[model samples]
Target: MHDDLIPFNKPFFVGKELFNIAQAVLNGTIAGDGEFTRRCQAWLEQHLGTPKALLTHSCTAALEMSAILAGVGPGDEVIMPSFTFVSTANAFVLRGATPVFVDIRPDTLNIDERQVAEAITAKTKAIVAVHYAGQPCAMNALREIARNHGLMLIEDAAQAILSGDRGSSLGTLGDLGCLSFHETKNVISGEGGALLINNPELIERAEIIWQKGTNRKAFMRGETSKYTWVDIGSSFLPSELTAAFLYAQLEHAKRINSHRRTLYLKYFELLAPLAEQGHIKLPALAQDKPANAHLFYILCRDANERQALIAHLDSAGISAVFHYVPLHDSPAGFRYARAHGKLQVTTEIANTLLRLPMFSEMTTAEIRRVCGEIDVFFKITSKQPCELS
Candidate 1:
């Protein structure tokens, strides 16, 4: 038909998504915490070896639940990087806690663990480590800071479902971890997430919060004869329909991760020449951290270079876009979050970072084509045009 327009992301579906949904519907339990929901939660718990896992409508819901469990409130401060998804800070802000924005490590674009320690104050209640681009941050350093300050550590692992740090699961290292199954994430459920409870003490309370602040989960387990509202919470559980769709994806999560990893390494291999020539910077990963190959991005020399490259890709019918508008610079951030350091790294990456097309269904030829466009853009910009199609 027409030149195939590559999209930034394409949601993948395994064979069982439909069948599982039909099965869930036929089972007559469309509500949440049904068979499929339990299955997904069990899968997460078993895979991550966490004490407990509770499904939610979205990663945002999971973060909010964690914030409630952390006892975050007015006058409390949570340290997090400004380069992350807003939910990382919004979750705590919803409970009246202030978000202290810090700079990110220039190498991995992760929250600078060193800066986190300096930001902690008497008002600090927690530290939220956002694993940028599915690469786990220095969880060990962040953990030490949290323990020293008596603050809770939360992993906003929305992009790092199966990643690890130093042989340990990425999300499982923190006191609380949150995962996303959004359309763009490695796993797809349209809209779903889970709260990963590593701290055994919070297991019972976390379950209660997932069940609309009631002891319904306890009742389901026969722990209580009757359930009622016992704490302040919300309905965060995902419906069986969402869980069924997610369960299908979870069944093939390893395969999906493998497919994406293949694409990721290929991108690096194809673009390494440019990086060597100092034309662009590829993703940097620490030796101890293993990525889940969630998204592939590059850093241009400057914001203008990034814009021109995006334009060239657009003309080639390829989707290339920038990411994150430095939450510290956003309007809501100004109102609810306070900047701890200069946030220079966050500001720079926010301007020059360009995310390339990534998906399980994308082919190697499509990836090569995208790389070709990037090479063309740089050559033409440097006034040394190279012809290739």
Candidate 2:
């Protein structure tokens, strides 16, 4: 990669991350569930209004824990969008559950709630809502469907931290929610995640699952005489060093999200003319459902145009990229998952979608440069040129 290139993402620090790591080392408890971990969990619970939040090594671990808590096993099926990351389906697949992949909405590129309803059967155990690009999914509709069918509702909110729908945090709306603090996310923890428990009944078991199936958390609180393996689980919790780094990011989450939102809007504003001219499709935005601006992506006319745009941006020393390939079409998807419908929308979006450079520390000038390059690309390709204002 070129030194001056505006890469797709760049991890940033906003607070005393190194200082906190040093403190964790001095405290002599660098393992999981240490003081730093407690602080991070408490911060999430307090902000999201969830009853409990348990930090984990990655969003994948959180999803795996949610699958176990939902009692999903062999013969059970989990409904989710085919446009999402592999972890969304892998968690349930690991538990011997079949992933029932569904199509996404053409506008938001999120799981279509209607498709989810149609995919349900007697064997269906849960519905996983992945908030793509930090935009909230149709949570109200999804919740209603889950309630009517008596199934677990899990939010794979890896890209959604401060994002909300109708005034409620994305992760807190479902029975269980998963968050990612990966470097690419608005909050930087190098590699970490958290699981938010909304259903009060799942709290106790969730804690046990987070602690490697042991009652160590209760023992630490002086509630248990001894701790031992009591249920099915794994080492899902992240170490104190990771938690310490995350706590710093969590402290400045609002500021980070705000800056990223500003950048997101800038891209939208600069590229609106092209969208109006039908050169591209911008991501759908809603007032009531505010996003954390975790990512900003646009859909070109087709896969060929997307590839051309990426190459054009690269030539200008700006790095842009494409998102996920539909999981339903992958080799593992063929082996472990099944599609509910034609999934035409998923395939189309997967082929055309291109994610531009977006990060907390990204500057408005950088966004303009990226947008300007995109304008040039369209001008060279099309007979009618659209100017970037």
Candidate 3:
């Protein structure tokens, strides 16, 4: 990679990260669920207002834990959008459940709540609402639907830390919510995640599952005489080093998100003229749903245009990319998942969406350089200059 290249994502450190790791080492516990892990979990619980928060190695682990807590088994169907990361479907599919792919709203690129109701059947056991680009889905409507159908509502909040719908936090609104702290996210710990448990009934089991299927937590709390393997689980907890690194990031999360939102708005402001002229389409976030500004993206005229734009950016030493080949169209999806409807919107968005370079420490000048390249691309392709006013 060139030194001048503006990479798609960059991990940042606020303060006290290495110091905390050294402290964890001095405190003599670097294993999972140690001092640093407890601090990180407590911070998540307090900030998100969730009843319980358990740190995991990655968001994939969190999703897997939720799948088990939901009791989804073979022949049980889980509903989610196809325009999401594979972990959203793979978690349940690993437990022998079939993922039912659903369409997304054209505006937010989130799961279409209206389509969710139609997809429900006697075999449908859960609904996974992935908050795309840190934007909240129609949670009120989704919650009502989940209640009416007696199905579990799980939130794939991988990109939505500190985001909110109405007055409630995104991850706390559902029975189970998963968050990612991957390096690409607004707040990161290299690679880490957490599962938020809102339902009181699932708390005990979630703790057990987080501890590799033992009552070890209870034993530690002096609530039991001894710990033993009592249920099915895996080593989901992250080491104290990861937790210590994450706690430092969590301390400055609000400031980090604030800076990223500023960068997000800068991109929108610079590119709005092209959008107004129909050269591209800017993101449309709902008024009541404030996001964490996890990423900034644009919709090109078509897949061809998007590819060309990505190549143009790469040539200019900027890294722009696309993702998720519409899981329903992938091979594993063919075997473990099924589409619920036409999914016209999902397919369309998948073709045109392109994510630009975004990071918490990104500068306004960098954003301008990226948008300028976009403008140049359109000018070259369309044979005309777009009005920048």
Best by lDDT: 3
Off by over 4 Å in 1: 288-290, 383-389
Question: Each model's TM-score?
Answer: 0.97, 0.97, 0.97
C-alpha positional error of residue 208 in candidate 2 after TM-score superposition, expressed in Å? 1.1
User: Candidate 2: where are CA atoms >4 Å away?
Assistant: 1-3, 288-290, 383-389
Q: Candidate 1's error at 13, in angstroms?
A: 1.1
Worst 10 residues of 3 by lDDT: 380-389
- lDDT of candidates 1 onward, in order: 0.89, 0.91, 0.92
lDDT of 2 by residue, 189-225 (tens): 9999999999999999998988888999899899989
Note each model's CA RMSD in angstroms.
3.0, 2.4, 2.3
Candidate 2 similarity to native, TM-score: 0.97
Sort order, TM-score high to low:
3, 2, 1
lDDT at 167 for candidate 3?
A: 82
Mind giving the per-residue lDDT tens digits that candidate 1 earns over 1-389? 22699999988787599999999999998999899998998999888878889999999999999999999999999999999888988999999999999899888899998788888889999999999888888888998888888999999999998998767887899999999999999999999999999999999899888888899988988989988999888989899999999999999999999888889888998999888777888888567323889999998878887898898898889998899898899999999889997888889889889999998899999999999989888787774322211
Model 1 scores a TM of: 0.97
How many angstroms is residue 102 displaced in model 2 relative to the true structure, after the best TM-score fit? 1.0
Give candidate 3 regions above 4 Å deviation.
1-3, 288-290, 383-389
lDDT of 3 by residue, 98-135 (tens): 99999999989999998999999999999999999989
